[model samples]
Target chain A: MNPLLEIRNLSFSYEGSKSLVFEALDLSVREGEFLLVKGPSGSGKSTLLRLICRLNPPLGGTILFQGSDITAIAPARLRRSLCYVAQIPQMIDASVEENLLLPFSFAANSSKSPPSREELRAMLRKFYLEEVEPAQSAMKLSVGQKQRLAIMRALLQDPLLLLLDEPTSALDQESAAMVFSIMERLNIEEGKTLITVTHADYKPVKKRPLNYMLDNRRLNLLP
Target chain B: MNRIIDISLAQLFLALLFILIAQISSFIYHLGLNRDITIGTIRTFAQLFLMGYVLTFILKSSNLWLVLLVFFVMVLSAMFIVKGRVREKQIPYFIPTFLTMLISYFATALFVSGVIVGTAPWWDPRYFLPAGGMVIGNSMSALAIALERLFRDLREQRELVEMKLALGANYREASDELFRKAVSAGMIPSINAMMGVGLVFIPGMMSGQILAGTDPLIAIRYQIVVMLMLVGSTAVTSVVVMLIVRRRCFGSGEEVLLR
Candidate 1:
């Protein structure tokens, strides 16, 4: 199958910084592929996801999403298709149900109908947040719950790819395990494409994921 | 209309007695405001006298170009004041903010003087200058507050805004809350003033007119127009400035660019 996303000779550096964060880095993710990138802290792991989402402009090279230059596509459209979940989940000052329904509020997503309450409740259950009341304030959720909720919200958009930054970095071991299980389910059962960047030594029990090490501004496949 | 009584220089000098009381309190309380009081007094006399002479010349000449030139100068000064107040180094907002102020102030002043007041020449120095000056001056402070709040809030809430963007919200949708807040910050003072206008105290313009021996009823009418004019100008100026500055906060990729 043709790659769903491709990166060619990507290079980026922060403004006024002498050193490059990523130099001539290359990556390709095919449909329904689960890829894990492990790196030390500040290894530009988060930057990689951001660059794919076009949150930060790449100084050189190109990002192709579905064989089209991401820059050529409208940013909101690109972002909606390749949704990102930040390391620390951010929730609006509203109910959990409202936060879940936030993406449909955008003009780009206006054509998509919001999930019904029954559907939303099922999603919350599938994400291991079955106890979370829809009407409860999203801000009151624990860090782990928020992360799961963030992933669930992204899924509601029905994105082709999910870019997760440190999906389990802030969770306890049990919570981390729960998140990993969810990731496995998303990839194996739902056949959803995922690119997860983490600094942890995590390996999914049920499926073998293509692993890469990001270090010294290079992404190398780990045999 | 009654004939106005003019105060002689000697009688005006007696007004210094009030300054003397303030100075005495400052000295006794060790407030160290004596220097500020002295400079303020000097500036009050020099600036007001200079403005009086300049107004005399402009009114006597009645040249439309000259009146417009004065209005431009006022707007330029107001822009710099706003620039000094909003301390954002990342975004180059000075030119856009200045242009917003110029357009909004000019349009609002023209409407008030030509359409409402029905000044014969429309650029009549007597009505246009003061009307434009008030619009620029009040909106200047409001713009500063709005810009300050906007840049500060954008920096503080960078993650929140980016979260919205990541969820496919456009720049406008992402920063909608911040935009509303900045506009509100700019408008609250004027709204509060409106609430307190006639009941809390006679406004400065109305008081000045009454002191100039204009009939109280007529003075009240002018004051009402001035008050409403300020509200309209402040709202328009703040909204326009915020709209322009909001675009500067984002990049071509629709990302939050605040450092």
Candidate 2:
């Protein structure tokens, strides 16, 4: 079974900061693996996720996606295939419907049709956004609703691999539980690869997820 | 050709007395503009007089090379202003800015010369220098606004762009909104000037033509041509600069080259 993603000797530092966020790091994920990364704030946990998707190019080293150098893949294609959801969801100053359909408008994703209205209503309803209209401004949504929308937007693209940064950090316990359940289904039942970065110890409720602790710019497996 | 009367040095000096109105007003208001006014007056006298002698020699010789050299220098000075004034700290824009000015300034210059004012040699200093100056100067201002807005928007909205990229947008797609805004901002000045031209104000070019004894109708025609030319060049200049700068600011792999 080939690895879905691989990082080789990755070394990186912020533009101004001298200290390396991640140095000489390496890791790999199998096609259906559910991997959870745990670390304190400023541990480069989020940076690691971004690196996987080639958001911030590593100063030194190579990333491989599906046996090809990650740099070789077109950025739009790479992003569409491996969607990333940030910790603080940022919404365009437009309606939720437009935001939801945003990815489908991209050249990479344009070939695919947007999710149908019924599907959208179902997704929104599942996330407790029942009262929110499709044309409601995404900016006016609560933080939790925005997070759900961001996640749903990514799902709309039908990504093969998903990298989520603290997906439920802003949610109430009930919302967080709902999001985690959805993530579990996507990882377990749907067989999609998932890599999640979080400060909390979030164990996968359904499938046994591999836990890794990042320290001193290295990833260590935890049994 | 009608020979025009020239203002004598004494008349010019007497005209200078009009400065007392501003000097007196500044004194009464305590506007602190006396120093600025003095320095500006002196600098205007010195620069224009120097430029007058230089231009007279260049015009007499009709040296195309010298004319082009001066034009090149003008372009350089324009880029220098953009470099210092544009607040973007990201990608090295000196070359892109230089390229933008070069394409825009030359395109407008050639259009005015080859198409509009058909000089015998086509690079006639009399037509090329002044026309190119207006095109280049106005285009420079347009590019300044375009480039400044582009970088500022990108810097301030990095996350928005990144999020777009994350959602699978190419650089052009990701920056569509900012790009449109910058281009529009660049063009708005000339557009607004076009709206207000001839009605609210007599533009300097038209007044200069009229003062030089050209018929008012003929001056108005020239003004209209120049106004249209300015708006056209500004649009072309802003678009070219934005296109080149857009490529420089965003990398081939869809990574933002801001750093």
Candidate 3:
């Protein structure tokens, strides 16, 4: 089967910088595949995901999402189908429910109805955030809780792929385990494709995930 | 009405006593502001006198093109001042920002002079120049504050903005909160002035008119029009500048590109 996402000869550099972050990089992920890219700090691991999401324009390259050039896609539409969650989860100065419903408020997602209160509460429980009240101020949540809440918020968008950047970096071991377990269920049970970038030693026990190391502007497959 | 009393050069020179008093206070307290005080005093005298001469020439010429040329210069100066104040190195916002300011300032000034004040020729330098200058001057500082707030907030709130973009928000939707805050920052001073006008303090224009021996009631009327014109121009300029600059904050892909 053709890959669900294909990146061909991706290249990027910071403005006015001499060195390239990614030079002639290539990547592909099959449907329902979980990709784990590990690298040291400043290795451009996060930038890889950003490039895929088109948050940072590539110096030269093409990103094909399901065989269509992502550049041809309306940014808002492309983003809706491929949601990205940052390492440091940011919550608006509003209630948790409002934050969760933010994507639906966007015109690109306007066609989809927002999740109902029951559904939102159920999602919170599924994400092990049962204690987080929908009406509670989202900004007041702990970092770990915010991270989980951020994931839950992304899931509400019903994206075709989820790009998570250091999702467990700020969490305690227990919370990290909970996040991993959530990732496991999402991949194995729900068949949601995931591309997570982290420097942590996280591996799912239930299934082996395709792993790569990003170093020196190259992605090398790890045995 | 009695002709307005004119101060001779000697009397004007005596006004330096106020600066002398300030300089002495600076010296006694070791405030280290004597140089700034000196430069400020010099600039005040030189710039005002220069402006007075220019106004006299323009008034005497009474040419519409000349009037517009002065306003153009004022707007251009105001644009550069805003650019200096904003200090954003990454985005090249100069041309768009200048156009926004120029259009809004001219529109506001023309409306005030032509419709509100009812100047005979509408481009009459006597009315148009001051009106245009006031609009540009007030809006210049306001635009600076607004642009500064915008760039700073975009940098500071990069994560939030990116988060919104990642979740399928367009540029406008992603930076909506920051945009509103920036525009508000630009307009708040004008709004506050409105709240305090004719109450806590008489404004500069009103005071000048009163000092020139105009009837207090007529001076109040002009002050009211000037105050309202300022608020309107500030609002329009801030909104327009922010709208244009907000696009600069994002990229063609609708990404937050502040850095």
Candidate 4:
């Protein structure tokens, strides 16, 4: 089967910087695969994710998502199937219900049926969230709750792929473990693809997942 | 409707009572009986009373030039308010604001008075003055908020926008999120004021006309027209100013000076 995503000869650099961040870098991920990308600071791990998500145009490279070049795709349509959760997700200053329903309100998701209250409750509970107060404001939520809320929001769209940047960076060990377990379950049960960029030891969840390390301007498959 | 007394003295007392309450509340907030409070109160009374007498004369005489002069002065003051409120003083702001006010207010005022209402002179003080004030008021607020929001969003979200462009979103799409947010914030006040007008306070225009002994029905019709004009001018001014400023803020290569 064709890979779900493929990055070919990706090269990028800051506008005025002489040192190129990456050159001739290639990477691919299959459908339903959970790819944990590990890299030290300043190794362009985030940049690779940005390129795949088309958040930043690559200086010289082509990114193929489902056989179509991402650069050539309409943004809202492309982003509809691919949600990127920043390291620090900025939840809008609205009620939790509104924030969760935001993606549904976007023109891209307008046709999709809204998740019923029962489905929302189930999803929240699946992520260990128990509250269902529609008026509970997002600003009052903790960072871990916000992150989980964001994940639940992405999941609501039934996105084909989720690009999470440091999803567990702000959570406690228990919360992080819960997040990993949730991701693991989604990978196995729902066949959802996840590309998570982190500096943490993802080895704990790599037992049944593909792992790669971005080092010295190259992405290499890790043993 | 008959729950209240209908005497003219009673109505005058009621109006005076409300005004007195407003002044006293303001004084209380500023610490009543202080020299600053006393001076402000005197100035407020003097200005309004003087304007009330002057406007009576202006309305009766219907001098077109005098009305135009007042409109011009109001627009100039609005421009200064916009400049003072915005943090970035380096921008040659007078141009955009003046242009925005002129276009938005004149277009709406001329259309409402000349084409719609069919004012004989079209520049009659009775029609032009109030219409001009309403349009200028709305555009003033809209321009101030829109410019501030655009500049602020560019400053704060420069990186996010850059990230979007890097993501292959064009400058328009990359800044699209911020653009929507800025426009929304700019219009929220006007929208809310509109929604809560009668409930929160009888809007100044309608109240002024009612107090001046016009039929309440006529006052309400004018108020309704003023509200529509305000909303229209605000929406137009906001979108236009943003479109104009967006060009200056970003380069052809989709590069933006966010900072």
| Candidate topping DockQ | 3
Error of 2 at A147 (Å): 0.4
Off by over 4 Å in 2: B1-41
Off by over 4 Å in 4: A15-18, A130-136, B1-141, B153-235, B243-259
Better of 1 and 4 by DockQ: 1
Q: Considering TM-score, which of the candidate structures 1 and 4 is the better prediction for this target? A: 1
lDDT of 3 by residue, B177-231 (tens): 9999999998999999899988899999888888888999999998898988999
How accurate locally is residue B39 in candidate 2, as Cα lDDT from 0 to 100?
91
Q: After superposition, how far is residue B185 of candidate 1 from its true place, in Å?
A: 1.5
Candidate 3's C-alpha runs over 4 A off are: none
Q: Candidate 4 on A1-223: residue-level lDDT in tens?
A: 9998888998898666878888888988889989889888988888777666665666898888999997677766777777777777666678878877777765566788887777777778888888646578988888888888877787778878888888999989887888888888888889899999987665455346778888878799988
DockQ of each: 0.83, 0.79, 0.91, 0.06
Per-residue lDDT over A5-34 for candidate 3, one digit per residue giving the tens place of the 0 to 100 score:
999999999888989989999988899999
Winner of 1 and 3 under DockQ = 3
- Report the poorest 10 consecutive residues by lDDT, candidate 3 chain A: A196-205
lDDT of 1 by residue, A1-223 (tens): 7799999999999988989999999999999999999988888999999999988998899899999999899999999999999999999999999999999999999999999999999999999999999999999999999999999999999999999999999999999999999999999999999999987778669998889999999899999
Q: Candidate 3 at B145: error in angstroms?
A: 0.9
Local accuracy by lDDT, each model: 0.93, 0.85, 0.91, 0.76
Q: Arrange candidates by TM-score, highest first: which order?
A: 3, 1, 2, 4
